[model samples]
Target: MVSVLSPAEVKLPDGSSTDFANLDVAATAPCLDVVAEAVADLLPWYGSVHRGAGALAQRSTREYEQARETLYEHLGCGPGDAVVFTRNTTDALNLLAHVLPPGTTVVTFDVEHHANLLPWRTPVRIGTPRSPGEAVATLDEALRQVSGPVLVAVTAASNVTGELWPVRELAEVAHRHGARIAVDAAQLAPHAPVDMAALGADYVALSGHKVYAPFGAGVLAGRADWLDAAPPYLAGGGATAGVSADFAVRWHDGPARHEAGTPNLIGAVALATACRVLAGADLSAEAHLVARLRAGIARLPHVEELRLFDAAAPRVGIVSFAVLGRDPDELSTELGRDHAIGVRTGLFCAHPLTRRLLREAAGRLDPSAEPPGAAIRASLGIGTSEEHVDRLLAVLSAPLFGE
Candidate 1:
């Protein structure tokens, strides 16, 4: 006779029990022991930060603040700028969108994450560009046409194609037309050092999890004035104090305004740790690995399509390629289920870029024709081993495309 069991009693791959149905990054990426140690550092404090005098509270406050400082230095944010802790890249972009003054026109490319695409209420979407110069020209043209206060929002790299956008040149073009720019560095920050000054973007947003932090924390680093003037992103006890019976209240300052409620001290610290770890790794070497992988994948049969946005543009450790006679979902699923290989598939929340790449490869627009089912994106960080690359290539090259 079979015995019924509670959901919590269900065993996992190695015979461990958990309460919830687990899948996705939240479940898979945090199983390592390193993550547990990183999380332990921030759990001892319960008292409110700045709202209490308790030792644990103060320590927690310090930990949170130090994480902010570490992130600031890591991203090259200067004294005149500030770092606002966000839930993720989408939250960061929303904060900026909410703070943008009315009549502020936005210039952005068609090839951006929905987080960047949906925020600007009225955006002048620059169509897909085949080269860095073309990308810059698209931004310049958009900025030239808009007649009000403007912000140019851009992705440093495309999430769908893993193609690097001309962010530096785009920033220059925006400034030349009297507009400031903000970069969606979610894809680039993890792969390289995001130098805001060097890139000349007015603001930059990134995710810790994507950078190997795998925590629920993120950051928005940029100019101080707009953030200081804008209202808080989240409203709660820690965001403001001195609420009156008459209903008036005074809000907190700097990062505190945006970060309400209890801060994730441990998550912040772990993110900081992850950033430091990645910082010391050989970036050039990782880049070389990415190039090698791209080159190798391009050589495979049934790879019917290959497109790298710009030959000369510097990129990070990411490759997105499609195979002929194979569905991306089937490929990604087989890779993971049969071979323990992991990669992301589908539009990657960037429909425009996916369509552009497919159209370019197809040589004609056929909305009805099943364009290659998104892309198979293989991304690497400091911890990525050569074995991962070899495994991915082997899976792709196996005689399974028609199966």
Candidate 2:
């Protein structure tokens, strides 16, 4: 079983205690028990990595390097690939953007999270497709149009709608056009297996916080040539091999070239431990739990579930919805204050996609005035339980807040 942190009991507005139903796992999953234990085990021997000659430093350095290898294996990266640790998914994608060769054109969809949407030099934004096949065709056409050093950036899963993209097919299209593809797997990695080599992706970025390791660590695993050739992400003592009195310095190659300064040793270990745990996890069980939650939500009246593709499209353990005649922000607050059910609200960092969905929902409602600006997202994962889903559905069905 996947042992996660015990849910905390929160006191409701009416002075009743209830276990916090954390349905916001897509934003930042709570730490796992094993990850906390790993941090405890490493704290005693903590030391500056790759610096001191003492036993503590040596042990810490070894563990840090081992964590890198663990992540590489978990992601199923190629032999020549390198894993560079960063603060989170945003940091990783920005690092890639900074290192891209000059005059590179990035082909991406406007529906991506801001982290993936931004940071590119010249982004050719693709229109939102109604289906997976349309998405693939749109990307193929866009890639064919762009010439010279093109990179295709895509999200493995929609953080807003939880729809999974056809990453392997997209990668094939990008390769056929002589371009490389980078996948933002922040939402996908937590609930599904992400094999970089199998997906034929040149790069993959994910966040630790979204995968039961909320210790401010993330990874960018892929080809090493561009990373090695680019300037160090941070210019510091650890990144330089030798420095002259006049300030001339030679930088180290490989992952160290991009990873400068003091590394997050504990965060890296926690992330690696989470990855190892997830590698052996039962994803199908989690999928079934998500399906149950979706079914419960479907039974609720006046609730419209948002989707980028068909209703039967395969998605991760996330569902976004808008309750008619109710403001999403107000409803989310009520869910937390009255029902002790935690969920996310608003555009969820995917403004374009959420806005489009809101417009569609409004058109279905009246085909007239402006669309609603926000929605609610209830995402599930290993930490979620059937009781939690039941509680949410029951609360939604009740007339507590006049819903």
RMSD each, Å: 6.6, 1.5
- List, residue by residue over 103-190, the lDDT tens digit for candidate 1: 8888887778899999898798887677888877777776767888899998887666556777788888888888989999887866
Give candidate 2's error at residue 45 in angstroms.
0.5
Clashing pairs in 1: 209-214
The candidate maximizing TM-score is 2
| Candidate 2 per-residue lDDT over residues 1-403, each given as its tens digit | 7778865689988888989899998998988899999999999999989999998999999999999999999898887899999999999999999889888999999899999998898999999899999999999888777798999999999999999999999999999999999999999998878899888899999999999999999999998888888888889878899899999999999888888889999999999999999989887877787788788777766666888899899999899887776777888898898888999998999898898897786666557646667988999988688899888888777574355
- Cα lDDT, all candidates: 0.71, 0.89
TM-scores across all candidates? Answer: 0.86, 0.97
